[model samples]
Target chain A: MEEVLRRQIEKIVTLTDEEFRFVLTHFTARTVKKHQYVVQAGDPAPNDHFVVKGLLKSFYTDDLGKTHILQFAMEDWWISDPQAYHNKVNATLHIDCLEDTQLFFISIDNREKLCVELQKMEYFFMKKTTAGYIALQRRILSLMSQKAEERFNQFIQLYPTLLQRVPKALIASYLGISRETLSRMSAH
Target chain B: MEEVLRRQIEKIVTLTDEEFRFVLTHFTARTVKKHQYVVQAGDPAPNDHFVVKGLLKSFYTDDLGKTHILQFAMEDWWISDPQAYHNKVNATLHIDCLEDTQLFFISIDNREKLCVELQKMEYFFMKKTTAGYIALQRRILSLMSQKAEERFNQFIQLYPTLLQRVPKALIASYLGISRETLSRMSAH
Candidate 1:
């Protein structure tokens, strides 16, 4: 688990063993069963989770009770409600495990303290957030212009592992396509 | 123009007069006439711009020749082909002036150097990127679930200034609605 996190951080910035140990002090670990809710709508979502193992999703349930998948976090990925964690507001999204999960998490306060204490971590986080911003821009463009077939194909191309690990219905929601349409597209 | 950027930075991090001057050294200022393209699709978009005056837009033109507005930057806002500017790739979107515009910009290299030399700038950028990520998530939710009228109303409520400054056709494009539909809604 330590190696999982250390490797993730090392991809962006090299850290001395002492520095890595210092960084670990700011995070706490947890294990959750399948179908567990990490964050619920209208409640405080205080930490950002980095998955060591298992799959989780963050979704919005609309007034009509229909759900839309905003994102997914698999092994080595991070998940959080941005408004809740960063702005200290209640969550507008629910995050839940699709499988039994083990994860590490850090609160906004700890993250800020860590960034201030380690300039390298600040740089690491800046890069990660910038990359996240770019990805969301791509998603917005795809949602605006792509057909259902194109969206599903792009999803498969970009995340073949996610395609298998994630349910077809959830994948359809993430792609913003009807389950029937997704089924039709996948049939080919 | 220097004061514009100074004030923007100060919103996130404090800087003394001398420190602000040091920060200004990394940016270049430019003035562009209306209809000029700052970033064209398929070209290198090397800088992230901070608008001091006038209006600009980042848009994607589809293969079928339909254009969709991704975002707009008026006074005090930033605009870029996010992927190209952050990832050092060619632009996938076109960014152009909607009016005569003046702005300050920093290249990715200069941004990195500035961040390293001044930790405050790194914090400023990290906060900005995180906020950008959150805003994009809201947009995704709006697109996925909202009807055209709700999307338009939300835009109007969130950016009253933008509604008046932007052309109806472009605003329609940004909202992912047809011009005629927007017209009927606006009429009411």
Candidate 2:
């Protein structure tokens, strides 16, 4: 589990064993079963989870009871209600395990302290956040410009692994297409 | 113009006069007229612009010649082809001035150097990127769940200044609604 996080950090910045150990102290580990909720709407989202194993998804349920998948986090990915966590507000999104999951979770306070104590971690986080910002911009463009078939093709190209793991109906929800439309596209 | 950049940075982290001057040295200023292109598709997007005056928009033109507005940058906002800028790839978006504009622009290399030299800047950027990520998530949820009228109302409430300045047709395109639909809703 620690290896997963160390590898992720090493991808951007090199850290000595002592530095890596210090970083690890700021996080806590957790194991959750499938169907367990890590974050739920109306509760404070105090920690950001870094996935070590298995799958989890964050989503919002609309007034009509329609669920829209915001994101899916697998190994080496991070997931959280970023707004709630950063702003210290009640979560507007729910995050639950799709498979029995192992994660390292860090509260905002600890994360900030780590960044302050280790300048490298601040650079590491900035790079991650910038990459995430770029990805969300790309997703917005895809949502605005792509037709359902095009979006499905793009999704498959981007996350072929996810296609195998996630339910097709949930994938349809993430793409904002009807399940019928997804089925038609998948058939083609 | 330098004061604008300094003020923005100071909002997140206070800086002494010497430090602010050091930060300013990394950026260059430019003036662009209405309809002028700051970034164009297929060109390398090497710089991110910070708006000092006037408005600009970034958009993608689809294969079918339909244009989709990805973002709008007014005074004090930042605009760039984030993917292209960060990944060192050719731009997939075009950014053009909606009105005569003044901007302070920084290349990715200079920006990185600044962050490395000043830890506070790195923190400022991480906060800004996280805020951008959260805003994009909110937009995705709104797009998935809201009706045209609800989106329009949300847009008005969030960016009343933009509604007064931007063309209604462009606003309709941004909201993924037809111009006719926007007209009908605005009338009511």
Candidate 3:
């Protein structure tokens, strides 16, 4: 179990066993049932969760009672409402478990402490955040230029687990396309 | 001049004068004229600019030859085609100056070296990137759920500088709305 987590951390940045162990001590293992709310809109977002298995999605419900997906996390992916978690503000998004999930959860305080205590951890998180920012920026560009079908296809290619677990309507909404449009595109 | 830049960096993370000077040295200052292209689609994104004054917009032209705005940057904001800048990929977005602008430009190589040479700079960038990610996620959520009018209002509230400088048609495209609708909404 520890080795698996170590490998995951290694993928981001190199860390000696001692540093990894030190960082791991602060996180607690969490099990979430399918449909369980890892987070809720309007509540303060907790620290990041490192997924070991299953799936989770960060989303929000609109004034019109529509759900819009912000991000989907599967095994080995991390999920959190970054603003709420980092700034200790009320979350503007909800994170829900799409499957029975196992995650390693760290608090904001603990994560900061880890960063201070382990330079490698700080470097890892910094790289991860940079990569995440790049991905989000590109996605915005794609949304601006690509058709709904193109976006849907890219979504499936990039995150197949989300496509499988999430309903088509929700996916359409996430893609900023109407359900009818998504359906029509899928039929083709 | 340095004081303003120092304050901007301080808002994100604390940096000693020595560290600040060290990181600042890696940046090369340049002036941009109004309506000039900083970078264009299909070209390599080189310099990530720290805007000292004036305005710029990052956008993409779709297959239909319609330009869609992605982001607008004004004084004190950092602007770049993140993917192309970070990964050294050919850019698919174009960045153009809306006004005569002063910027401190840093290449990715220099950025990496700065991070290594100055720990405080790394922390500052990490925090800034995290904040940027959170903002982008919120924007994506808004795009998914909100109507064009609501988005336009939010956009104006959040980025008044952009609303003031960028054309209404580009803002309409940014909100994925028709130019006529933007005019109607803004007139109200």
Higher-scoring candidate on TM-score, 1 or 3: 1
Candidate 1: tens digits of C-alpha lDDT, residues A78-144: 9999999999999999999999999999999999999999989998888888888988999999999
lDDT of 1 by residue, B157-186 (tens): 999999898999999999999999999999
Off by over 4 Å in 3: none
Q: What is the lDDT of residue A120 in candidate 2?
A: 92
Please list all clashing residue pairs in model 2, or write none if there are none: none
Which docking category, incorrect, acceptable, medium or high, applies to candidate 2? high
**Highest TM-score scorer:** 1
lDDT of 2 by residue, A1-188 (tens): 79999999999999999999999999999999999999999999999999999999999999999789999999999999999999999999999999999999999999999999999998888888888888888888888899989999999999999999999999999999999999988886
Which candidate order results from sorting by lDDT in descending order?
A: 1, 2, 3
Top lDDT: which candidate number?
A: 1
Cα shift from native, residue B9, model 2 (Å): 1.3
Put the candidates in TM-score order, highest first: 1, 2, 3
Q: After superposition, how far is residue B34 of candidate 1 from its true place, in Å?
A: 0.7
Residue A62 lDDT, candidate 3, scale 0-100: 80
Isolated chain A TM-score, each model: 0.99, 0.98, 0.93
Candidates in order, TM-scores: namely 0.99, 0.98, 0.94
- Residues B125-180 of candidate 2: C-alpha lDDT, one tens digit per residue: 88888888999989989988898899999999999999999999999998989999
